[model samples]
Structure formats: structure tokens, C-alpha cells
Target: MRGTGLAGPGHRRGATPHRRTISILTLVGVCLLALSATQTASGEPAADTVDTGFAIPFAGAPGYERLAPTQVTGPDQLNQPLGQQAADEIAGQVGLNRADALSEEQYRDLVAGGGVGGSREAAEVIDACARILTNTNGRPLYSHVDGHPTPSVLASYGLYVNTSGLLESPANADAPTRQVNSLIAPGGFVGTWLRNNGATHTLIALYRSAYTVQAVYGFAAQQISGAAQLVTNTREGVSSEVGMSMAPPLWIVNFALLYILNPSLAAAMPAHWAPIPSAVADAIRSSATGQVPFSDYAPYFQ
Candidate 1:
């Protein structure tokens, strides 16, 4: 008999075997991509299937309209759990202690003290422990010095935000929204307003005394403090790990709270790469439109 490895009589004349393999693989990729897109996040697609289409998650710039401190957050931005309010209320009672630092009993007592959100299910308790962080000194993380957010503070997030440009930049020929947004009074809310409809959460977190600020910060500090990075949320008395979340490299992350609360600090803020005002505005618009904005600004910080 002929060698078994020899080509079979049914082999096609012109098409190479590898060509058939390539065609099948290409078809498979297309079908998988379509399936991945159709499935909800709960479907939990395979890593290879999911990674092929997803963007890396990170904070993008706030919108031009949101910078105004007046516009309300649409529904898309307010997806927190029903219990988040209770969680914050409990947090307010605990003051600045990291949720885990407290025993389950202490946590419950704190919740009871607030007259809100009782003991969470054992499984849900972990998330309940989660709260907005604080500065290294463990004080209120979002306090503002009064008048407005600082220009340099906004610039770090790529806004070039100033009282004059709260809604848009001044006469900067380089900024995209200069013409239209410039003349309008800034009507958009910053802070949680950028991500939700929690009006005055920013002020409630900032102007409130230490305990109240801690409560609000426990609820929504990331959207409020550090302009977005570093120091972690820990008071001098707590364990270093208790509240410190998201310790982005201090080298790249400027201390935004320094200027956000005290606009005067912007005067001393050393320039890193200038944030692109147009890009920031585009990010804001994208968020408003329910699209993901390009968040990879590592190069700008560099």
C-alpha cells in the first residue's frame, strides 16, 4: 500500500492545506468577536475573547459642561448600589477609620449610630467596608478654599480649568470649546456631579466638619479629591492599609488637592507636560454621550 501520510485522493488541486486552516481561523475570530459584543458582562466570556475588544479602564477628563458646577448628572452616571447611601451614612459615623479596621461589631455599631444601613451580608460586607479614601494626613480630602477650582488643578486632568474657563477656556486659540462654551456661565457641577446626580456632595464633603466630610468622602472621594491620585486616604492614627486606595506613582500624579482647595497653590504648581485642553473637552463630551474616552494619558504626565 502507498504511504499513509501521502495526500488523499480528495485533496484539492490548487488550495494549500495551510490556506484552509487560515480561513477557518479568520472565520472563528469574527464569530467570537460578534458573540463577545452581544454578551452582557455577566456572561463572563473567556479572557481571550474579552481582551480582544475591551478598552483599559481608567479615569478620563470631566466634560466641559460638567466643569461648570451647575449641570446635573444624567442617569448613566449614577449607578451606585441602593445601599451606597446607607454605607456613606455609616461611614460618616465611623469618621475616618478604614472599614476593615473596625470589627464587624464596631462596623454595625457605627452603622447603628448613623441610624442607617445595618450589617451587610457576609459576602456583601467586603464592599460595604469599601469607602472613599483620604489624604496622608487623614483630614477631609475634598475641601475647597472657596471661590473655585484652580486652573492648574484642572489642567492635570487635561482641562486647563479656571474660574474664567469653568465652562470653557478663555481666548486660547488652541482650545476646542473656546468659542461656544467660553461665554456661557459654567452650569455643570464638578465632583460627583461629573459622575452622578448627587448635587452638593462636593460641598457636603468639603465644607462639612471632619466627621461629615469623612462620611461623604467614604461615599465618593475619588470623584472629589486629589484631582485623582496619590497620598491615599489615611489619617495619622489609622493603619497605613486601612483607607489608602489607588496609590498611583507620585512622580506622575501631581497633588491636585493642593490647588483644588487652595487655588493659590496653582501659582507654585510646576508644569509637567501641558494637558491638551481639546482632548480633555473631547473626553467630557464622550462621557456625556455614553462613549468611552481615550484615558491613556501616561505620556502627558510623563
Candidate 2:
């Protein structure tokens, strides 16, 4: 079970505590503002896409032969340090005092909580990240925004928009600006790829408890199915919307290729032949179906 202390001030169900530090350069907000501006120029309104299309990544697939048993647990063990880094970065960029957002102890509490991200406070932190990912038109790489983009709001939290050298135009218009073109190509697929490999594992640490680990991992395996279904559904959606008869959407290709190539996910071996109990596996299946928060299993963490 979770420790029996005060459980900390930032330990609310949906909010993460604010860290008082910031980064040397407040780039995240700048980039978001820039993107918001560009998106506005494009004139496509904010996103109202169906939530059904937004799926957990690892739903169902084959050839997950490399996923370690430990990979399935909560992300806290690995993410605690990174989250702190993010918090610190926010603090430095905004030049705000830490006491206003998060104290050291409260920050630690949030990191220990595996970034479950559903609370009102958590929204503030995530909103900063979202602003960074979005374009000037209030659209994210994958979705549109509903309100005026708020790049300034998250500045206090260490999220800056760092376009830095990206604004430089290329020598020729026929050739694209390498930096701007990069974001246009895919939706953080490269980052996701890095995360899938062992690079992000250290930052997204596992839960120490055996059961919590199992449940968390089990849920991830099921994301393969969900991702697959999304591809099938999206193919039809895109075909009807743009009137383009292109082959499969790039997202399908990206997800499918990554599923097969992710050696760690392959190793997870979600099939029935695995030695883990059916009941435990069933729990994971249910959790995925319901979009259950993995932090619910936090009490079992060792």
C-alpha cells in the first residue's frame, strides 16, 4: 500500500504539483506561440475530432519478443527525475519562486506518483506541454485546439517555446525548411520511437511492486490492439475527408512498422502461452478497455 503519511499536498487525484525551477531558455512557449500563429494563418479551426480515434498505442500485434517483464509497470520509477527536470526547467524560465507552485517534498510526491495526469493541477502542467506541441493556429501536430492558444500561461511553469534557429528559411522554396518540415512530417513518431527503445525506459521507471508492474505492463500490451483498430478506422475517415486516394495514412504505417520493430514490445509476448496468470492478464485487458489510470495501482508499489 502507499505510505501512510500525509500523502503530500500535490497528491490530489488529477493535479501534479508545480516545481519552482525554470530552464535557462524559455523556448517551449515561444515555439508554441509560433506554431499557434502559423496554424491561425492556415485557417483550419481548432480540433473537434472524435475521441474514439485517440487510442492507447500498444493494443494488439505480433512479434513482441523483446519486452522485459519489468517494462509493464508504472512509469514513476523512470519518470520521476525527468518530471523534476521539467519542473525545474519551468521554474527557471518563468523566474517564479518555487513556493508558489511546488515545494521539494510535493514535487517528490508527484514524481513518485508515476505521472498519472488527470487532476486540475496536472492539467496546468500538461497544458504547457500541449502549447509547445501545437501550431500557431491552436492545433497540435495531431489535433486542433478549441480556445485561443495560451503560450503565456504556462511560462510560469517552465514551459517555453524554443524555435531558436528553426525560423531560418532554406536556400530555396522548392526545398523545404528542414526544421519546419520536420514537424509537418509525423506526429512525434521519432520521439515515440526513442521512447519505445530503451532510451526512455530509464526516465519512465517501473513500479517496484510485482502486481502493479504486471497490471501496468498488461495494459500496455493491449494498446497494440487499440492502435490497430484505430488504423483501420482512420483509414476510412481520411479517405472520405480529403478525397485523396493515397495509400494508407502515414500514421497506420508508422504504428504498424513500429509495432513490428519495437524489440522490447515484441518481447512482452502478450499471447496466451505466456506464463503469467490469466486473471492478472484479464485485469490489464479490463483496464485498457476502460482507460483506467495506472496510478490506481500505486499503493502496491514497493
Candidate 3:
């Protein structure tokens, strides 16, 4: 019978060839499952799905002329949050030691003197912090002595500014409109106004006594005092963590704060980047607009 026609290794050894094929396929599937689990633990996005088609809002630039009455946030989302975080850290350090370092009278004098004995870098950081914390639109009130005078652009997530300025200062239902305006007249109050409008729970800043500022939320005053202290201490190198990590490294923190307070600027910031669109760029140049219109950049937000 031709030696039973069973060629030794050449013929398939299983009783059912189809069953053997299925068994091999099962083994391959098991190997793939183990590999997928490893990828997940390492923080990798899954192979079957990818992060796409979703963008953090980028307004390209503010548009002053097209301003509408709606609440409009300027581009600094990342810088605003990072600024708050840095400010909070600075505040905690200052609060712990402010009383021992100087009397209330001395502290007042130092702040009035543009933050004396502090690193000029520290002074600028404080200014940057105050700007973001106090910003209404993407524009903070003070301009940087060096670098871009307007608020930093923000493209990533964090805090953002509304250009309209009006949104952040909507009159408190229970408080007189005049009472609210009283807090806004000085070169400050952007942050305080935002708080009054229920946009945030708290806001803080370190400002010169020259500015007449008030917080609609009474408790925010204490927070401001603490923030001022932090700015003072960081400049003086009083806090080791701030001195070692944040002060000398003010460039990083300051840039980061700018990124948070004005996300659009942050996006537009950095060397060799394209300028924002003409309209957006022009609006940013015109601080008077306070913020850009939502309709112009609605696509980015969507």
C-alpha cells in the first residue's frame, strides 16, 4: 500500500489539520494580549486608538475691533495656572517667616520701593505673577521691563483671560455697582474682578501700595498679603526652595506663569515662532480691546 502513505515529518502530525491551525492562532492571540498589557503600564496610548482631532483652544491672537459683549478669555490658560501654583508656593514660604523678618511698617516701605533688596529677577517674577493673577483679558495691567510687554500667550490648559474685562467684573447681585468699580479703578483689580464675578474661588497678588486695590471677597486680602510676602522673600533669597528652585530659575517659572495667564501668548511666544494672524496679532498689540471676540476664534475652541 506504498508503505501506508505516511511520510514521517512531511505529513501533518495532528488528527485534524484545521484543529491544529486553530491552536496555533490561539497561541498568537495570547502573545498579543500580553504585549498590550505591557504597553498600557508604560503610559502608551493604545495601538488601536490614537489621540487626534482634539485641540486645546488656540485663538492665534486677540481681535480688538470685533469685540462682542460675551465673556472672552484670552489665550493664556497654561501660564495662569502655573503662575498661581508658583505664587501659592511663594506665599506659603513668606507667611511662615514674614513677621520675624520685618515689621508691618518696614514691609510696606519695601513693597512701595518696588520690592527692595530683592533680585530684579524676583521683582519681575512678582510682576508677572501679579499680572496673571490680576488679568481680566489676556492683557495684564503691567508691562515687562524686558521682553513682551503684554500678557504671555497660553495654548495649553490652565487659566485663561477674557478680553472683554467686563465679564470678570460683572456686578455682584448683592453689592452696589459703584462698590465694584471702586475696586477696579486702580492699575490693578483684574484678578479681584474675576473673583467677584464668580469665575474663581480666590485670587492673589503682590502690588505696590501705590495701587488702590480691593478684593470683593474679604478673605482674598489675606491671600494677597501672603502672595506679596512670597514675592518679597523669593527676591531676598529667604526661602531655600524658592531660592534654589524658583528664583535663580525665574526664567522658567516666569515663562511658565506667563504660559498659564495668557495661553495664546504662550503659544505665540518662543523664538522663531510665526506671528499670530494679523487680526489676532493687532488685537494683542492693542491692549485697549481687553480681549478678542469669541466668534473669530470659535473654531479653535470648538
Candidate 4:
């Protein structure tokens, strides 16, 4: 809701609707290019074409590809070793027990109850969650390296982190940052938040899908009760339009907030949400101009 009026840099508060639309379109192009560049630079392989053994109802739909597992190194940290401390922490925060690993039979039963239009939809949800939790090596992926945290790996499976910028120390530490901090304080949404406050409806839909996936896992593991009820609730919230219809605009607004706005305005954001420091921005520009490789920004990733 906060960014409903946002266009892009140079956009005035009362800018014409046409201009705003153009700005959003341009930003969408930029985001696509950035994602392409990232994939090329990382040399990640194309998404796996292997059938999931479950039909994804929206598989070929626009934005559905975002739900597929990304080809990243060490992406299977959630399931290996069975009871990782971090996974346990995530489960506890989401009302689950770490000691209760889901059994194969239980997983099937839970998926059967998903009520997602048909068995195929249910199976798709299970497969997606399995991909997030386990990797190609049949081992769990680690979410952090040393002291540095990585972007939520679940994002590749269509579950964006609801705690965006919460860990960040914004320059001004504004009200919005404070609000987000409070929302994620209890960590119930570590897997996914069922309720929406400040985030967009589309985002909430995405979170719901993630929540359902986790709920199925929890049910299978015997960590939580009322699996049938949870599946019914989650099924009602699934949407096919969220990724393409809502996410791109939201991303554009966030990008403007973090990179295109003037320093003063950017600093007004929460520390984690703040724009890249001028020094870093300059370095990026230099790298873009061939003065250095983009790897110069590797420190920021750490």
C-alpha cells in the first residue's frame, strides 16, 4: 500500500497516469535484463525439464516459471541431515516440530488432502516443496555461509521472504521499517505468512502457496495437527496471476526506492532497505563501463 503511488525516479507525486505506466514498463524491462544478466554471469544451467511426476496446473502460465527451482550451488540445505538446527528454528517459528520429519507415506497422505482442484495440483505443491528442501545431491542446502546470510532459497520456489529489509539498518529507520520488523519478530512467517498487512495481495497469495507447502510437510512429519483444515485454507488462496500481474510492479517500486531515488529520500528508508551507498553505486557504474568485473561487488553478497 505504501508504494501504490510510486512510479520511478523523476516521477512527481501527481504525474500523469500515462507517464507512470511508461515508467513501470521501463522498469520491468530493466528487471528482466538484470535477471538475465545474473543468470548468464552465474552460468547457472537451464531449469530442469524433468517431469515432477506431478502436473503443475499453471506450469506454462506466465510467471509460473518463477516457481521452479533455480540452478544454484548448494540449494538443498533444508532437507538433508533430517533435523538441522536452522530448519528446526524455521519450523518452530512456523508452529512445527523439528524432530518430526515427514515420512514418505505421510507425505502422500498430506498431499492427498491438499484439495487443490485435483491430485495433480496437490502433487505439484509437494514436488515444489521437495525441491526446496532437498537438492540434486540428495542433501540439504545451507542457507548461510560463515556469518553471512543468503537470499531465501525458497524464493526460487515462489516464496519470497516476508522479512525483507528487517535485518537491515536503514539510515533513518523510518516507520515502515519498524512495521516490517514487528511483523517478522515472531518468525511465524519464516516459511510463509498467512496474513498480509503491508505487503501486496499478490505477495500474500505467493506466501499462501508456500505456507500450504510447509503445512503439508509439517502434517506428514506429525509436527502439526489439522492438516486437512490447513490445506483447505491454502487451496482457497492460490492464484495464477500473482507472479506476472502483481510482482513486477512491486519490484519496480522497490528498485526505485533502493537505487533510483535521490540519496536523501533513499536514506529515509530503513537501513536494510536503504539505497546502495554512493561508493558502491559508483563502483557498480565503473564495473558496468568495463573498468572492472561485476565480481567487484562480491563483497556485498557476503
**lDDT tens readout by residue for model 4, 105-127:** 43344345432222454344333
Where does candidate 2 stray beyond 4 Å? Answer: 1-35, 38-86, 90-284, 287-302
In terms of TM-score, which candidate is stronger, 1 or 3?
Answer: 3
**What are the runs in model 1 whose C-alpha is more than 4 Å off?**
1-105, 108-278, 289-298
Give the higher-TM-score candidate: 2 or 4. 4
lDDT of 1 by residue, 1-302 (tens): 00000000122468676874564345435534553454332212224211111011111111111111111134221111213233333223222112213334433343343213232332122121111111111111121124433212222222222223232211122222121122111232122221232223333432222221121121122222222211222233431210012211111112122112222221222222122334443443344321221224223322
TM-scores for all predictions: 0.18, 0.16, 0.20, 0.21
Error at 272, model 4, angstroms: 18
Residue 30 error, candidate 3, Å = 76
In model 4, residue pairs whose N, Cα or C atoms come closer than 3 Å (at least 3 residues apart or on different chains), thus clashing, are 76-140, 76-141, 77-140, 77-141, 168-272, 169-271, 169-272, 170-270, 170-271
Model 4 alpha-carbon drift over 4 Å, by segment: 1-83, 98-104, 111-118, 136-302
Model 1 clashes, total count: 11
The window of 10 residues in a row where model 1 has the poorest summed lDDT is 1-10
lDDT of 2 by residue, 6-102 (tens): 0001123543323211210122233234334433221122233223221222211111111111121333321111233433332222222232333
Backbone clash count, each prediction separately: 11, 59, 33, 9
Mark the regions of model 3 whose C-alpha exceeds 4 Å error after superposition: 1-80, 83-85, 89-181, 184-278, 283-292, 300-302
Candidate 3 C-alpha lDDT tens digits along 73-109: 3543322332334433332322211121233443233
> Global lDDT of each model?
0.23, 0.21, 0.25, 0.26
RMSD of every candidate to native, in Å, equals 24.4, 23.8, 27.5, 22.9
